[model samples]
Target: MSDPFTFQMLVNYLIIGAGLMALGTLGFLSRRNMIVMFLSAEMMLQGTALTLVAFGRYHGNWTGQIFTIVILTVAACEASIALALILILFNRKSSLDVTLWNEIREPGQPAIVEDPAEAEATEPVPGVESYPVLTPAGIEPEHQTWTVHRD
Candidate 1:
């Protein structure tokens, strides 16, 4: 049989779960990318599930595991729906930035619009691309020009 779950272990699990929840909350609040936000939300859910499982195990009951399973099912459904919404939103906006979605806010709410000058200032500088660059490989072959005569 496995060693019994101790109070120290439970505390440790709770701490880790809390950390994950905090990180997820920070990511969800600070990031502007839709996909990143979605992932953050999932992280938060996972943290909650972890805490539930830890508590259930510490209490010597099946409740935590069962709740975690239910959470997983809900997360799976949420994933499919969220992905579809993201795809549809991307198709309409051509961007994954959440700031572009202010138009969908509640009717009574004022739209949040960025100033043109500030937007320009925030734009990425040219020649400093974020992606990696590949160098050319091998030598270029010489080509012979052939003349065609028509009669």
Candidate 2:
């Protein structure tokens, strides 16, 4: 209900909002865990909402309140979807490190490892075939020896 030009009010709002933003950014950047990353993203969203509310209060406008509510709803949806995705990824890989996802390549194709050292190699038995051949439905096949060639 007043002009948005008070020095003390502005400083207070900036301090709170910017502090939240800084914490969110730090978490997002420094944390390797996917859960923490998602939480940090939500923190950023909360900081943005806080800034909006502060501006709305200072300018005596209802639009900022409406926007803040919208942001909250969007944040909820994002959290739900992100959590679901995290669960699925964890189930598949059993780890939340972004580095584990390096197998994901562009164009939706499985990434190829070039060097033998970089590849996950399996120990082979002396007289046994290394690769097993799998046939289509209702078909049985023989096993074979195969060497993977990498770039």
What stretches of model 2 exceed 4 Å from their correct place?
1-7, 105-151
Distance from true position, residue 13, model 1, in Å? 0.6
Q: Per-residue lDDT for 56-130 in model 1, tens only?
A: 999999999999999999999999999999998877777788888898899999888856466435555576674
Candidate 2: tens digits of C-alpha lDDT, residues 23-95 = 9999998877899999999998888888888788777779878999999999989989999999888777676
* Predictions in order: lDDT: 0.88, 0.80
Question: How close to the true structure is residue 50 of candidate 1, measured as C-alpha lDDT?
Answer: 95
Q: Which 10-residue window in model 2 sums to the lowest lDDT? A: 142-151
Looking at candidate 1, the ten consecutive residues that score lowest on lDDT are 142-151
Summed backbone clashes in each candidate are: 0, 0
Looking at model 2, the pairs that clash are none
